[model samples]
Target: MIQLVIVTVLLLVLFFGIGFILNMLMKTTWFPIYGYFAVVIVFVVYWGNAGSLTDNLTEYSYADYIPAIGGLIGAILSGSAIKALRTRGFKMF
Candidate 1:
């Protein structure tokens, strides 16, 4: 359990670190884009390691894709909502 927690934290740090790099490369200050990139990176990492990580559980499963789909939906919704609010001249408070 402790190992799982440590690995999880390390993965999160990696995701955010990559996100920060992407933000710098794109020259965008918005954090939502970075958040989305973090999710993408996590998903990619999971997919890449699925065979080894989930070998004992199963070879293939739809559950593995849930995180990727959820991340994509969340990013899209957040981006659209922010765009809509900005266009309406409303500040998020």
Candidate 2:
């Protein structure tokens, strides 16, 4: 369906855009993959429990917002994880 296509594209952009920004900020490449994966995991969680939350966001149209939320969560998680890894002497090469 067109909706699914749009959702996928938006999710990819959201994930990649956040990842690219973090990669640039930290000067590393792996962070992007981390961010992307984080987003995917979050999306999976949301997908698993859509009815519970989707009903609350009645103002919004379409379920694609789930991935957008995932992207935001992923961005935050990615930043924290990257920082934590660096603090623990994990070097990205």
lDDT of 2: 0.61
Clash pairs, candidate 1, are none
Kindly provide the TM-score of model 1 when superposed on the true structure, using C-alpha atoms.
Answer: 0.42
The residue-by-residue lDDT of candidate 2 on 1-93, one tens digit each, is: 677666656765676567656765777746766656565556644566447655535535456566565556555555666667777887664
Task: Give, for candidate 2, the lowest lDDT window spanning 10 residues.
Answer: 53-62
Q: 1-93 in candidate 1: lDDT tens per residue?
A: 565555545554554455444444554435655576675556554566455645533654555444445444444444555556567886543
Give all TM-scores, in the order shown: 0.42, 0.42
